[model samples]
Target: MHDHGSLPALGWSEFLTTWSLQPGWLLAVVILGAGYLTLRNAAGPASTVKGWRVASFLTGLGLMYVVVASAINGYAMALAWMHMVLHLTLIMVVPALLVLGHPLTVIAETGPRAERAMRSLPVTILVHPATGTLLYSLVIIGTHLSGFMDSMAQSTPLMVGEQVAYVVSGFLFLTGTIGEEKVRPDLPYLGRIALLVVGMVPDTIVGIVMLQTERDLYPVYSGARPEWALDAVRDIQTAGGLMWAGGDGGMMLLAIGLVIAVVSSPERRTKMTGRFLDGVRSARLAEESARGTTEGPAEPGSVDPDSDEALDAYNAMLARMNQQH
Candidate 1:
């Protein structure tokens, strides 16, 4: 007969077990988290285009990433490279991209009595550079420590702690990436640049260590492999490689994206589209004043660049104000 409980260790405690499924708590968290987020959104004023996009991503992608993966793998995924890959993708990629979509702010600030909570100190602190950096580092190092991952995988409590770590770390990292209100305006550009670089340090170290190792570090996996696949050492090393090579690359991408975002602000972008309009306005104003064309058509429909208006009204006003006189 097959020995079900007699399997060998697949390095369950070596951390980086992206295959570790978190079914029960993860499901409850998703259901409740989504509901809470939805209620918060409802408390805000009117919904916005951005808000809709955020909601769509969270409901469609986020829920799937959390529920399905957690349900399938639980804590037994340390041995599965494929599942690890999925876990990392879900933890970092989804969170970062979803944050880039800016769903929370869209739902919170643009909706009705939009909660000021998002802008509150507690929220801001959660997304601050310090917080993101700490969360990212600890979630990686603390969880992966041989003792922690092994011990935790063995019990329900530690397993749940793992869940909390991943979720909170992910949330913080993404929020830091996408938030402007949580901006570290006081931080010099170079400082922000260095912060990101520093954040990648642990991941780089972990990946390098894994790649260099010849054997599996985690003794937690109690299962055997197909032999053609990775042995313990190779798997552990590959986990490192995945972090350093892949994670470092991700950090670089985020840096590039940030630079692009800064340079591509609407105000900065407006130079291209608004330049001709402004120049034409200046020329016409000079011409009309010289010609005494009755104080320039009263400019009654002129839309203030600083004011908010319906798209229709704004477009209509802009068209009228730029009339030849």
Candidate 2:
């Protein structure tokens, strides 16, 4: 095990000042940040992409740097709760911000070839919401529930690998569910909301298991824990609680964001209303066609196909559903 014998007790001042200069991670961030800006600028006046996307993307990159290359990394190795904080930030908050950036949409705008490639079979499958959810579930459950944590603490490469996996899995999941990439099929807002809500289940499960487990789950922490670190059991419980709160809380916030986006977008609301009206019209036409085919002709007493009664009833049903009447 790497030495934590000389590690200082975590405090606000130290947390603020202590940072690991991981040149490799920093270089990656700089490159990605530069690339995103270049693409955003390249899209130019023709693009409708907003300014906030650029900000969100950069902010996400910054947070990723802090999580992996800051004092958090040091504390995380010796403290379970700190690790949970690092994990949740990497997997949840950072990914959500990046998704909001719409990087894929920006890339697709480069040319027809790029757009087509984005919509290619392999890319489509990789970004599918189901695939993302499955990978996310596996990562969360595998890393926390199994012996991966024990191994990760001792192996630098494994630690880096785990961090990379968290970001990738999260990015894939969010990119599929909440992303509005122009090259991909638009996921209905309601469907996006549902996916986010369901995704919280794995976090809840892992958190509860960690919080309630009777025995120490990760011996590695106990062995490497600094003098000031919480005892293993208490530390794990705290970590569990943090995971449960952070995971569900982050998902809920994102769901609410989707709800706000739907409510705020007049085009989306209009589209939904058009769909409802179209469904009603289709049903009416089918009913008329069926009556004509079966009875051969309409009787004098038959309801008029153009009558407003059906539309009125539908409106009333909607009002009732909304508790408006």
Candidate 3:
């Protein structure tokens, strides 16, 4: 462990050395690099894979280094607020970037065997939305429990486990909700928006409770104070603020991206229009049924151009008529 005295002036050498000692960071770098190289080498003339996907994957790996192998991790062990930042990065930023890279899709495209493996029953169940959501919620709630947090702080292995859990849960949540990977049927843009909105509730509640609490929830930080001079109570409060503001801020950004995606997609626009027309037709049918009356068909060659429903129903009819003529 780096000395607490030099934390205020920690240098790059110390940061690199400390991070290199951790097996997790080394393992992550190897896996990420290997995956990217494999994908690149496997690409053929017909491959549609682009450069941005590789960049995104590398960016995720960099984020992992920052969270676990940098000076930030050193400070996190001694400060509640820093730990919260680490947690937020692991559970939100890193996973979002990885999912956006479409790693699973890339792997599947590599070969038939890989595609088959991705579609196996166990993989299917693991990537389901319900499973992802439940696992994510469990990790968020479980790690925050008083006993668990303190115990994690005391044991290196447990702390590493907690970090791993955050990454896995975050990946699962995004994969199940908004990722391009075909785990189950893809969620429509509206469904993605709704899932993200509802997911914010638990994080918001946890943050608010942390902020309101009078006592320090994690005692491990009390003993090893950072050189920058943050008290335990203040540290806890700062952590709460990070979780509240940072977590929500990340979610809001993702929501904005989803909105952009929806608006830009021609297919989604067409689907929405069809759904709107179907809904209108269904309501009209139900109203007619309730009134115990049936409307006569329109005159074969006429359209009520002034009526909104008539216009909607016949808008494409004009195009067909023009083509026929």
Best by TM-score: 2
Model 1: per-residue Cα lDDT at residue 127: 71
Residue pairs with backbone overlap in model 2: none
Model 1 residue 298 distance off true place after TM-score fit, in angstroms: 35
Ranking by lDDT: 2, 3, 1
Model 3 quality (TM-score): 0.79
lDDT of each: 0.56, 0.82, 0.72
Residue 64 Cα positional deviation in candidate 2, in Å, after optimal superposition: 0.9
Off by over 4 Å in 1: 1-26, 29-52, 59-80, 101-107, 110-116, 181-192, 222-229, 266-325
Across residues 154-261, which tens digit of lDDT does each residue of candidate 2 receive? 898998999989999999999877788877776667677888988899999999999997788998756888878788899999999999989999999888887787
Q: What would the per-residue lDDT of candidate 3 be over residues 1-325, giving only the tens digit for each residue?
A: 2234346644577556555456767787788878766875685554455678677877887788777877677777777777888999999889888887777777777788987988888988888777877888788767774568777766778888988999999998888666866434566567667777767776787788778878878765455665565767787788888888988788888888877776898655433334446466545433433332266544332432234655555555566569999
Better-scoring candidate (lDDT), 1 or 3: 3
Candidate 2, residue 325: how far the Cα is off, in Å: 15
Candidates 1 and 2, the one with greater lDDT? 2
* Candidate ordering by TM-score (highest first): 2, 3, 1
